[model samples]
Target: MARLLLLGAGHAHMTVMAHLPEIISRGHTVTAVGPLSRHYYSGMGPGMLGGTYTPEDISFPVQQMIESRGGEFILDKAVRVDAKSKKVLLQSGREIEYDVCSFNTGSSVPQSIVNANATDVYSVKPIENLLAGRKRIQSLADRGKISIGVVGGGPAALEVAGNAAACAREAGCKNVSVRLYAGKVFLRHLSPRVRSLCASAMRKHAIQIIEGSYASGVATKKVTLEDGREFDEDVIFIAMGVRPSALIAESGLPVGNDGGLAVNRFLQCDEHPDIFGGGDCIWFKDQPLDKVGVYAVRQNPVLYHNLIARMEGGELQPFDPGGEYLLIFNTGGGTGVLHKAGISFGGRLAFFIKDYIDRKFMREFQP
Candidate 1:
């Protein structure tokens, strides 16, 4: 039996955990490792700020699920990979040898804005950080008016701004204010109509929007822009997207210009077949996929099948990520927006659809 080591409890890896029985039935010993006890669905991240779901509602207990499936679960972070030795180094100063390994560690928040006066600045990552930021906002609301600043203008930032506004209102803070610094352009990834709709929603909630500039520095209570303009910000949330996880690049694996691990058609490391990867951490030029949840979700079945095949010495299957997929944004208050290709729509129905899909996905990992 081959020893299969699955790294990270990310969306893709969690799928593998759910199918541990299938892998074990083939005479393979599976071990899953990560730092978090539970895995949060990023789709419900906006729901977190909007008071629709708690951490428990959006996350699944990783360790419990793996253990129930009779697979080993280690709650430790992977810091290094010795491809030549076929071993993984953990943060606890231990190492594990494996016949095969798959990484779905997701991405890390970029620290370009980290500075000496970045006390009140927080990076939105690991999901737990967002929960902690929510608590901090709730607590600070009791003191006085709260100035919430969001950096980034993508779909994620839009959802965060809207949900945060709703959260502030639900917390009984009437003087809550939100400012979105959408570096350069706003919603450039969406169609013009969709962008207009999103901008309208933020404006309706009185979220101050700033365009054509990025945050140059952050202070304890202020954010300075590249144009030398500054604003008082009580709390700043960094949602400026993510970069590849450092473990992949540091492992001396082939990586893309973006630092994401270079993977081939079968999701195997371009340089090492025994080491495979998927999710936000991988970059496959032939099947270039966006660093989004939808691709990772779709890759689960393929990854699972290929891993089993690789162990059985069977032919590998190629992965092809087809054209555009739907993009939905929960705009708080049981309303949301949906966009795909050149089409766009918004309503409570959209939110319901997103909620149903998210719940269904989370249910698969539930005990």
Candidate 2:
């Protein structure tokens, strides 16, 4: 039997770890290592942010699930990989030897962005960690009449804008001004209907949708745009660009233009077949898809096949990500917008349906 190590309890590993016995029964040893005892899935994070669901609803026990299948589970971060030796260097100073490895460690914001002068700044990643930062924003918002700026136009940014507004209202902030700042039109990936729905919902919630402008930096509770315009911001959430966790890029692997680790169709590192990857950390050969949770969720099966194949000396399989994955994003006032196949929907019922669908989607992963 070969010793196989899983580097993170991210989306892809969460999917396959639940079925770890299948991998074990095939005569391979498995080890799952990461800092968290459980993984809070990004798919259900918006719900948590909007107060539609509790934290427990969106989280799953990773260590228990993997250990139950007779695999060693270590709650630690992987610092480096010795590809030639087939071993993972753990931050805890332990060395994990493996015959095959897969990485689902995911991505996080740069400390520079969060530690900058922007005290109100927040990055939409590492959902659980975001919660602590969100709480600080919530407290400041409670003081009333807060000018909130969401510094990105993507779905996650949209959700931050919406959730920030919702939390403001929940904290009883009157005259709250929530604005989204993007260098271009918001929700550009969606169809016209979806865009209209999103804007309409933002308007209804008293959230201002500001487009075609970038947030340059913050100074003394004020945000400066690229056009030299200044706006008061009691709270700012930096929802812009994502970088693969620094350790991944530092591993000396081939990477895509955005500095994400380069991988073949099977999510295996192009330069090192024995070392595999998934989630927001990997870049496919053909397209530069964003590090969305949907794409990470889609990588599960291929990662499962390829990891096992590598352990058993079988053929590696290709991962075919769906052409378009659906997204139901929050507008921040107890409402959300839906997007799929260039189509969109809005309104209260739309938000309710979105909640139902998202909750049901995560249920499949529940034990």
Candidate-wise lDDT, in order:
0.85, 0.76
TM-score of 2: 0.91
Name model 1 segments beyond 4 Å from true. none
Model 1, span 58-130: residue lDDT tens: 9989889898998999999999999989999999998999988998898877767668657767777777777
Model 2 lDDT per residue over 99-201, tens place: 8888777887554534355465666777885676557666776566778787777777777777777777777777778888865778787677877887787
10 residues in a row with least lDDT, candidate 1: 111-120
Q: How many backbone clashes does candidate 2 have?
A: 3
In model 2, state the lDDT of residue 39. 83
Against the hidden reference, what TM-scores do the models get?
0.97, 0.91
Off by over 4 Å in 2: 110-118
lDDT of 1: 0.85
